[model samples]
Target: MSLRAILLITLQQEPGTGYDILQRFKAGLAHVWQASHQQLYRELDRMRGDGLLTCETVPQAERPDRKVYHLTAAGGEALDTWLAEPLAAGPVREPLFAKFFAWERWPADARRRELGDLHEQLTQRLATYAAIEEEWFAAPERLTPAQRAPWHTLRLGQRLTQTWREWIEEVLEEGE
Candidate 1:
């Protein structure tokens, strides 16, 4: 999916300033789609030009005017159209898988180190998800209708991470 589509869904979820949108990506959507600072700002402007979004300038006391993006009617329609279409299966571009393929070339010690590093990264991600759950989703039953989708996505992330971690542990144990 294009950054434009993600931006549309984001604004549709809750309109906010550019910084607010960036924070949303960092907090949640970054897990699904990654975008650079420049990509986001440029896309927001392009979306505005395309009439998919409207911007409102709010003056601050000492800061530059904050531009808040609101989804236009066209943007909503675009998002709806995009949602209705079936997504094609994307290629698995995992570099770790490539490392697995090249396992014979790397020394055994180096392989262990790589596996250890991956395990550490996955553990850290799980910890981050746990933190997010504790901070925002302590009580899933109380989530608003709008929050349900995100909550489910978080659960999915946790499950996927656990599965990956388990697989890594199995591989490491087998290698010993």
Candidate 2:
């Protein structure tokens, strides 16, 4: 999905400043979609020009004015139409998987180091997912209808991370 669609989805949850949207992406959407601050700001401008979003300038003390965004009716329609379309499975583009595919070419020590690094990264990621899950469970009432969809995606991320960690452990054991 285009970043525009993702931003629309976010705004549908609530009107927010660019920073707020960025935080939302960092907090949850990073699992599936990622955008740098510059990319998001540029897209916000484009989406505004496309008439899919409306922006409000709010004055701030000791800071520049803040621009808050809200999805327009057109944006809602665009999002709904996109959601109705059937989605095709995209090609896997994992760099780590690519490295594994060429493991035979790497020196033995390099392979071990790479595997160790991946294992460490995956372990840290799983811990983060666990924390998020715990927070959600602790405040079930805070989850809104809009959050339910992303919550399911978060569960998928947790499961996938767990599976990846298991596979990494098996590979490490095999290398022993």
Candidate 3:
């Protein structure tokens, strides 16, 4: 999905300054999409220009003025339209896949070291997903409709990461 679509989704529930939106991205949307600070501000500016979003300048007591963005009617419609459209899978460009494709170029010991590092990274990612599940979705049956959507997305991520971790384990064992 495009960053524009992601921004629209984020601003739908509430109005937020750029910083506020970035914070939410880190906590909520990082798995779906990631953008740098500059990229976010640039997209926000473009959305404002397109009349999909409205920005207001708010003055703080001791800080520089901040701009808060609110989704306009057009923005909501755009989100709805995009949501209804069939989602095509985006391109998967994984560097590790390339590395493995040329596996004979590397020594066995080096390959083992790289696999070990990758395994650790995936392990950490799984731990993070588990913690998020524990804290946010401990009782899925009790969640509101709004909350259920995100919980399902989290579950999808967990299963995908788990599959990758399992494969990595098998490959590592084979090399051992």
- TM-score of each prediction: 0.87, 0.87, 0.92
Q: Which has the better TM-score: candidate 2, or candidate 3?
A: 3
lDDT of 3 by residue, 1-176 (tens): 89999999999999999999998887777766789999999999999999999999999899999999999999999999999999988798888888787778878898888888988887898888888788778999999999988889888988888888888889889883
Task: Indicate the TM-score of model 3.
Answer: 0.92
Better of 1 and 2 by lDDT: 1
What C-alpha lDDT do the candidate models reach, one value each?
Answer: 0.88, 0.84, 0.89
lDDT, model 3, position 67:
96
- Candidate 1 yields a Cα-based lDDT of 0.88
Worst 10 residues of 3 by lDDT: 25-34
Q: Give one digit per residue, the lDDT tens place, for model 2 in 20-129.
A: 99888877777778888999999999999999999999999999999999899998998899889998988877887887777788777887888789888988987877
Question: Which pairs, if any, clash in model 3?
Answer: none
Candidate 3 runs further than 4 Å off: none
Alpha-carbon RMSD to native, per candidate: 2.0, 2.4, 1.6
74: Cα error in model 1, Å:
1.0
List candidate 2 segments past 4 Å from native. Answer: 139-148
Q: In candidate 1, what are the lDDT values of residues 90-123, reduced to their tens digit? A: 8878887887777788788988888889889989
Best candidate (score: TM-score): 3
